[model samples]
Target: MVVLVPVTSVNWREVTRVRAAEHQRRWVADVTYYLCLSAYDGLWRSCAVQDEDSATVGHVMWAVDPEDDSHWIGGLVIDAAHQGKGFGRATVLALMTLWEHEEPSLSGTPYAQAALSVAPDNRGALGLYRSLGFVETGELSDDEVVLRRGRPAQAPLRGSG
Candidate 1:
């Protein structure tokens, strides 16, 4: 079984191992470490996707928008060795479930929405997001495309089990 666990209580060394193995540079691994630390500071939140054996296979990061306090998924990374194995899809789904159950502030910000940007050339990720009900919002950067999925769009698919 796959499990999504809060980054707050996870072991970073394990996460670093997976990241270092997948990414080309130690910089990527270092950035992941700092990102989790920043998230734990309560300025943001992140999680790790682990297998039944407790091995971390992926990670997702998000932060509450300061202007609106709406949660925005900042990054997602599944270990290269684990790609094409459905873990990426499962991880995003789990994150969405967690987001939906979370309460919004009294400001009536709706349930907020989760968004992510992927490289335009990343057909696998684009297809996975679309299959999971995320719609293309626009371009996020010079080479990245943005996708968004709100709570309403998320409801009908809850039975995807």
Candidate 2:
């Protein structure tokens, strides 16, 4: 069984250790943990996936923008040992559900739209996102491709007279 745990209560060192072991590329592991910490500080939301044994196998960070009310999935990382076990997709879906349930005003805005950027070479991640209803949005940087999920347009205004 996979479980999502709040980053606030998690040990970053442990997470970094696991990631370093799993990711063969030292830079990837380092960057993943760095982004994880940055997201926690900026968004106040980060999560890690724990297996049945309670070991963290993956992590993700997300937040809702205060100004435009847009939701952003900043980063996702699955330990190499836990990769290809469906944890990545499961964790993302779980986070989306949580976002959907949050109050729109306090959370900024709850629209059917969630955005994320992934390396163009990450076919596995692209496939997973596509399977989960995320589509390419034609927005790209030199190294990353931007994707979006949920309803195509902004949701109807809520609580408006």
Candidate 3:
């Protein structure tokens, strides 16, 4: 089973070692760049994607957007050797579940949805996200297409007659 382990000083080195394949290098930044970002960006949190044996297989990070209270996932890089083994999907799903149940935010406001940005040409990632219910928002960040998966609709309360 894949688990998202919070990055700490003890494991930061292992997390930084996670890297992407040459072709995917264009889509995500180096793990160190993200680690440095989390250092200054208080809202951002980084995690190491570990496998059943607790060995790091990838890296992912997220931040709660203060403006819209959206959980924005960024800097996801699955080690080239670990790609195609479902670690990417598992990591994303685990984060989504965490957001849904934990509602991470600075203002205590619940996140309306989970969001991510992908390069227009990253067909593999686009496909994976779309299949997981993330739809394009017709927006772009750093020239990457933005996508979001919203919470499922809740049933309305019935009025007593």
Candidate 4:
């Protein structure tokens, strides 16, 4: 029963409390940084991942690329103590579930796919994303390998003139 609570001025304190394991810190930055991103970018949204008991288990954020009109999920961090409990998978699935229903403002259509990047060496995350259908796109972002899931974006229908 994992749930996502959008990070807000009222809940940022609780969201910031979620942290990754010491070693996993290299893969993700502090939650505060992600929250700051959301504050500065209207297109970016961050959320706190909570378990059935309502305890904060992790944090994740997503954004729609204005250039490509693609949905991108990033800044996923499961608290040090909450790892190996499937919260990571749940959070991602929860995000997909949300997007599956909403129309992107630019496209006026449901999100066709989602993209994310990962450090090539982060085996755990790579495994998680791969298991959930993300495939390598032979692309890189900030030196991280890019992967995407769902159907590729389709060209807009041209009015038959």
- Top-TM-score structure, candidate number: 3
Each candidate's lDDT (Cα)? 0.66, 0.69, 0.88, 0.87
Which digits, one per residue and each the tens of the lDDT, describe model 1 over residues 113-133?
767777777676688889988
What is the Cα-based TM-score of model 2?
0.74
Candidate ranking under TM-score, highest first, comes to 3, 4, 2, 1
Worst 10 contiguous positions by lDDT, candidate 3: 100-109
Tens-digit lDDT string for candidate 3 (37-147): 888877788889999999999989998787787889998899999989999999999887777777645337686788999999999999999999999999998899999
lDDT of 1: 0.66
Better of 2 and 3 by TM-score: 3
Sort by lDDT, best first.
3, 4, 2, 1
**lDDT comparing candidate 3 with the true structure:** 0.88
**Residue 32 lDDT in model 4?**
92
| Predicted candidate 2 versus true structure: per-residue lDDT over 1-161, tens digit per residue | 57767665446655664452343353244534555556656764666677788888877777776755667775577777777778878788777776766647536566657888778777777888899888898988456898887644546788874
Which candidate number has the best lDDT? 3
Cα lDDT of model 4 by residue, 3-80, tens digit? 988887888898989989999998899999999898896777898999999888889999887777678998999998
